[model samples]
Target: MDLSIINQIRSAFENLPDYRKPGNNLKYAVEDAALSAFAVFFTQSPSFLDYQQRMQKLHNRNNAQSIFGVHQIPSTSQIGNLLDPIAPETLFPVLAEMGDRLYTQGYLEPFISIGDTLLVALDGTDSFSSEKISCPCCTQQTLKNGPTLYRHTLVTPVIVAPGQSRVLPLPPEFVRVQDGVDKQDCELAAAKRWLTTWGAHYAPRGITVLGDDLYCHQPFCEAVRAQHMDFLLVCKPDSHALLYEWVTDFERTGEVQTIEKSRWNGKQRMTERYRYLNQVPLRNSDDALMVNWCEVTILNAKQQVVYRNAWASSHTLDEHNVVEIVAAGRARWKIENENNNVLKNHGYHFEHNFAHGKQHLSNFLATLNLLAFLAHTSLEWLDEAYHAVQTAAPSRRTFFENLRTLLQFIPFDHWQHLMQFMLYGENLLPRKT
Candidate 1:
C-alpha cells in the first residue's frame, strides 16, 4: 500500500471535529465513521461497510481498517448520524492540500490553459428531492397548487483545460438554509458566498471563471473581478439587450470590428468569426462596469453554422488570443460532462441517497463522494500502479466492479496487492470464496 497516499486520505477525515459527546464513549472513532462513509464512495458500493464487517468476522481484517485507516466499520445509519452535524467546510482544507500535492507532483501542469490560467467552471446541481423527506438544510419551494418540493443543491467548481479531459475539482459550496435570512437561498447567492469564502484561496492563482448566461450579470461579473479573477461569462443577445445594442451602435459608428480566422480541428477545417469591442458598458445604468464583449461563430466546409456563442470578459478581445479564450470558455462543459454527470450518472451514483438526516447529511455525503473522486483522479494522474491497473481493465466501470468483487471474495492486505493481482493475474490473492 502507498502509506503516504492512504495517510493523506485518512488525514482529511481526521480534520473534522467530533461533535459527539466525549464522555459517551463511542464504538467507532469519528475519523473511523467519516472514513467508513467515504469508503462507500471510494469503492462505489452501497454496502461497503456491511461487507467489511463480514470480512472482519472471517479474516480478522478488512479493507476499511487496512486501506482506509478505519478502526471500526460504521453502519449506514451510524455514518449518516455521525456525519450529519459536521459542516462540509470542515473538510475543505484537505482539497487544497490535494491540489497542492498535484501541483508539486507536476500533475496539474497539463491543465493550464491559455493565459496561464486554470479554467474553473461553476454550476449548481440538484442533489436530492423527496416530498416526504425534508431536512433543516433542505431548500423548499411550494408548488402552485401541489405539495412543496424539498430539494438540495450544491455549487461545484472544477479546474479544466481546453484539450485535457481530466478535471480537478475544488471543494464545493452547498446551497442550504442560512441564518438571518427569510428568503430561500439561490444559486447566485451561493456562488457569491463561495467566492467570499474561497476567493482568497484563488486570488494568487491565475484563474478564469466560466459560467452560463445567468452569471453574465453586472453584480456577478463585478464580484469575480473584485476577487482579482478573470471571467468568460455567456452573454446572449436577448439577455444582454443593452450590451448588444451598444454593439449595434458601435458597428454603425465603425468602432466595432471583427477578427476572422480559419483553423483546422483534425481533418475538418472550420472558419471562426470573432466580433469584439474592447470597451463597452455592460448595462444601461450610468455606473455600470466597463467590460469587453466578444462573439464567436464556427462554420464548417459547407459554410453552415456549427457553433455560436457570445461572451463578456475582463480581457481585451483580439486576434492574438481569441481562439485560446474561446477554448477556455467552451471548457465550461467539462464541469457538467466530466464532473457532474460522472458524479450523478456514470458510476458514482451520487444522487442515489446514501442516507439523509435532519441536518447536514445529504450535502455532507456528497462532499465525501467528491473527495473520493478527487483522490482517485489524483491517483490516476500520479500513481503508476493505479494507472497500470486501469490499463488492465477494459473500462472504468469494469475496473471498479472488479475492485468490489475482489474485496468480497477475500481480504487484501494492502491496496497495492489488489492492483498487483489485477495487473499480473498473480496468485497472491487469497481465496475465501
Candidate 2:
C-alpha cells in the first residue's frame, strides 16, 4: 500500500457523499467502508466486522475506532444494517471512476495495444444467488414438487488484446423477477441492457465485443450493430443449424476456402486447418445481417486431432486480418481462466460468503474488493517502486505474503510510509517533519 495512492483514493471518496453522509454526526466516513471492503481480499474473511476486528488487532492494537476513523467502529450488525438500506448505484460509479483513474494515470496502457480496434468480452457469471439469501433481485423458480428461487448477474469486462493479463470489469446488472411481469430474466436480456447503457459509451472507440455461442443470434448481432460496435461471437454447429445448412449448400457449389499446414514443436509435430466463409448472411430474413465465419482444427504428432472450434464475426476477414480476428475471438477464455477463476479459486475467494445486506451491502463490498484487485493489478503493471519490491521477492504470492505480514506487525500513519519501508527493507517511522 502506498500512502500517496491511498491519499488519492481518499480524495476520490471525498466526492462520494452518499457513502459518507447518511445522517447527522455519523461517525464513520465512506473511506472506512472502502478500507474494510479492501481488507477482505487479503484476509479472506467472511464478514466486514471480522475484517475490522483483524485490522484493529493488526494495526490499531484492538482500538477499532481509531483504525476505522470514527468514535467507534461499527459492529457487524451495524455494517449489515447500513449496507442493506443503501442503493447499489452509489458505489458502482465510484468503482468505475477508480478504473478511469487507473487508465488516466497510465497504469493500463502497457496492457493495451496501440490499434484502432479494442476487444471487449461479455460474459455472465452467478456472483450472488441463493435460495436462502433471497433479495429483491433474486430470480424465482417453480419446482415440480414446490416453489423455487435464485439470483444471477451478468459480468462484462473491457479486456485488451487476447491473452492479456488484465481485464477491467464494468458495473454488473443483476437479473431478478419483474413485479407484475411474468418473464424469467436471462443473460441475453441483461447483455442488451449492458450494451445499451455502458456499451454505448465505448462504441465510438471501435470496440469488438466477444461472447459465447448464445450471443450469435440475429437479434443480438443486430443490437450490437445498432450500437455501432462489432462482435465475434461463437457459433456452434448445433445452434446454427440454418447457417450450417447454408454452408453445406454453398460448399457443394465450391464457395468455401480451406487452408491446411503442419509444423513441428521439437518433440511433436502439429497440423492446423482453417475453414472460412465470407460475406455470408446470418439468417434467412430479408434484412439478414452479413458476417464472416471461420473454423479451426489442430492435430498433434500422435496423429490425433486435438482442437476444434468455430467463430462468427461482424468484421469481414481477408488474408490480412483473419488470423488476428480469430486470435482475438479465441482469447475470450482468458476472462474465465484469468479473471473469474482467479477471483473464485485463487486467493481472492470471490465466492466466499461475505455479508449479504438486505440492500446494497453485498454488492457494494463486492465492488470495493474488485476495485482493490484492479488497483493491485495496476500497481503490478505500472508502479516502478512497487514492481521493484516484487522483483526482489521469490514470486507474487511470496510478495503478497510478506506484504501482509508487514502490515500485521507495523503501524504507519499512511499507506505510502508502509510502501517505503517495504521497498527499502528498513524500519522507518512516519515522518515528523
- Number of the predicted model whose lDDT against the real structure is largest: 1
What is the model-wide C-alpha lDDT for candidate 2?
Answer: 0.67
Name model 2 segments beyond 4 Å from true: 2-8, 15-25, 42-72, 102-115, 141-149, 178-181, 424-433
Each model's TM-score, in the order given? Answer: 0.94, 0.85
Pairs clashing within candidate 1: none
Clashing pairs in 2: 2-416, 3-415, 3-416, 84-359
Best by TM-score: 1
| lDDT per residue (tens digit) for residues 1-433 in model 1 | 3566678878777777778886775886778888888888888988778888998998899888777778878777777778888887887888778877887778877888767877889999988887889899999988888999898899998998888878999988888889999988989999988888889988687888999998989999889988989988888988888898889999999988788889898978899888888788888898988888888899998899999998888877777887788878888999999999999987798788778887888888888889888888888877777877776677889888888888776788788777767766533345556
Could you give candidate 2's per-residue lDDT for residues 399-424 as a string of tens digits? 77776666555555545555677776
Backbone clashes, each candidate: 0, 4
